[model samples]
Target: MEVSKKKPAAGVPAAKEPAPTLASGKYTFSKSEALRRYLSRKQARSGKRVSKAKRDEQKKKPKFVEKPFNKGTRIVSLKKRPNNYPCKNHSKPRSKVPKKHGATKVRKSLQPGTILILLAGVHRGKRVVLLKALKSGLLLVTGPYKINRVPIRRVHQKFVIATSTRLNIESVKIPDTINDAYFRRIREKRAKKAEGDIFAKKKKTYKVSATRKADQITVDKQLLRAIRPHPDRKILLNYLKSRFGLSTGQYPHTLKF
Candidate 1:
């Protein structure tokens, strides 16, 4: 029997292409000691660069848990770490701020002819009458100058003690509450008047400004009607007289323009 050494003819199956090499553009398959060391070093470097990746990922994060906000309630978050006290990791606490002035302050509700007793200053213990709520929430009070000798002026609600007296406004001439600008102008005019005639002069006119007329109007007619006169007028008058050395005049004196 004889064997043929010639290459396999086309009629027979070609030998497998020696298993095509598995190589990327620049690298070939390798398993040398240097290659192993290079891979180990590369992995070690990557691990060092992001050493905290796992620990940080495991660290708890604040979640947007749904919560109901309360007006007077507060909540704080705390973190616990190994070997450190819980308080040590805390952020600086917020400082408490005082309430807004408008919120902290209180204004007394008043109406025309509400009797008030002075609670502070030189007029302490003196009884007066509330004319109206001025533009700045101050009460316009008077002792009717002619009657009780207390002049027309602005007084804070904090400085007066309110009385049960509420006089009828049906005939009371309530002057419109003048603003700061009006008072400023009046002050300037008075100062100028005190100075020489070369200063500014006012064109006096009796016709009232439209704004003044509007302010004079009652804010709520129903409220006004509901304000009944104090039942103990005689008793209150007697008390005022006895306490502050006052006089019960023949008529109720009100502050008017």
Candidate 2:
């Protein structure tokens, strides 16, 4: 009996042929060549030159991630009072001037017998007797000549005159006129007095005999311990010179002390 040949399956597709395997060969590479190849591949992978569009997109994205405030969060706010608050308080009706002994508003115009001290300005650190208070804000003085046209700004808060080595406020006086000429004259007189005092002391030094006999003097140990070269002084001076363009004086005394 003859039989028909079995038919192949209708839906099955043909399988692809396997690729041929490479033949085993002795592969060789120099150390430098192998390293160069590795480095080139690494650089090519890492150095991915970005396009401008990608960079712009990255920049447009928000950098920080914000979260909604939690229900438990608390808010606080503070407001500052204006600087004119005190002025407003003083304008109230009950703010009349008190009638106390030292509660006078005008301060009596700094009349004579009111000693005033030189508080600030060019005459700072000096004590002068106020002879009289001039209408032009000048001060007259018994010593150091009259300080012509001394401005009210130069006078201190309180004036006291030295009487018999005791300071008293009742003996002081105020002057009327304050002018450049008066100020110059007073300054000159003070300078002359200072010079005279200095010369007098120097002259006395020549006449005074030395009383101390030769003796071995011991140096203070504490002073020696403290007398180290300042570690920060050089660095600070250098910084000042570079930043502020300041120059130290040439005098050795000035440089150190």
Candidate 3:
């Protein structure tokens, strides 16, 4: 038999010599070591580096095999079955985030015209009449400002103590204009002043807007109309005017609001 020798092409390097084999016909170098040297030599001749991804693709990876307890058992190729046809979900995925500020439910004891005792804020311990519950879950209450100094304001239901005493305020019409949005104060864009000018200027007083004053007057008139004809009018007015407080030997649980 005659062996053929191929001539190397111009500008292209010749192939490397085959890896040395032992008498048993096995490579002297490990498969991985031989592959690494082959890639390095090929890269040097070509003057182009083999990318890690490309090198990894070219590398012969060992197949995963489960170890056998018995040496007599034949090596079987075990493959994970692909999920080509996955199980379909009949229900939608549950949302991770909850929606902000859903409408608050009204308490059974808290109703329109029910007098609530303020449990928090500057007006704490003052009695006020519940006009309605806002969409944001805040209760709309007023001091009638005539009976007490508590102005028409929004208070959380949790912060107010509901009384068994109820008034006939169904006749009073709450203006559609007065809602959660009504109480939101909009900041006016002011001209930027120098740091020195800020201190030089007199501290500005926060006066209630004209529209807010008008709204307060309008609501108060409606509330007063309902209160004027009540049979226990004098006592109710005195009760609202009084401040709620705990004295010596007095417990909240023992006393009813």
Candidate 4:
């Protein structure tokens, strides 16, 4: 025997059931009274409602309450006086003046006559000789001006890279005149220009003072004398004259400075 399948009527169509939606737009989930009542009953059954009610009752209680004097009062007395003899705090407060900061620690690699490559500034990449550290915590260095044109000046230790090159300068004594005060630029007070000359254009020129020239000559003389006996004297002078820089294939990290 043969079997056949049945199909829907031609003029009719299938319909989909509508999903439930919330009436209020304030919340995504339903918060109907039935849901509130069910949650309240669940909390009550779980013993949370009792604790919440107790907290609310405690919040409603007065923090301080007055009582009748003789109802439950107890009598007490002090046997001796308390130890607050100096109650006004007569002691002095700590000093407000700040303590002076100690000098900057010199690096172990730095010493008199040690060559240092300056990292930053107008004369950066130039090598200079370490003379001594100033009381103000700055390094006193010089390029001997004759070799690299780097004058005797102060530089922060942080901005310098020490090299392995060192010269024996036991005989080279830095003069006391070359302290921090020596490099300070003294402002010469110019006499007020005559009213007649006020409009005249005058050119201003700066020259190295005789004192500075003399000092540089003195220091360089001693320094050169010490370097003269060294085997690599010419090489040392050339090294100080040349500027330090990295080429295309070179990197600072791999270089053993």
Ranking by TM-score: 3, 4, 1, 2
- The per-model lDDT (C-alpha) reads 0.57, 0.38, 0.87, 0.85
Instruction: Give candidate 3's error at residue 12 in angstroms.
Output: 64
For model 3 the local lDDT of residue 47 reads 80
Model 4, runs deviating above 4 Å = 1-95, 188-205
Determine the backbone clash count of candidate 3: 0
Q: Which stretches of candidate 1 lie over 4 Å from their true place?
A: 1-109, 180-257
Pairwise lDDT winner, candidates 1 and 2: 1
Clash pairs for candidate 1: none
Candidate 1 has an lDDT of 0.57
The better-scoring model by lDDT among 2 and 4 is 4
Decreasing lDDT order of the candidates: 3, 4, 1, 2
Comparing 2 and 3 on lDDT, the stronger one: 3
Worst 10 residues of 1 by lDDT: 219-228
Question: What TM-score would you give candidate 4 relative to the actual structure?
Answer: 0.58
Worst 10 residues of 3 by lDDT: 71-80
Residues 121-193, candidate 4: write the lDDT tens digits: 9999999999889988899999988899998889999999999999898899888988888878767788766
State how far residue 135 of model 3 sits from its true place (Å). 0.6
Tell me each candidate's TM-score. 0.35, 0.18, 0.60, 0.58
* lDDT for predicted candidate 3 compared with the true structure: 0.87
Runs with alpha carbons beyond 4 Å of true place in candidate 2: 1-106, 142-257
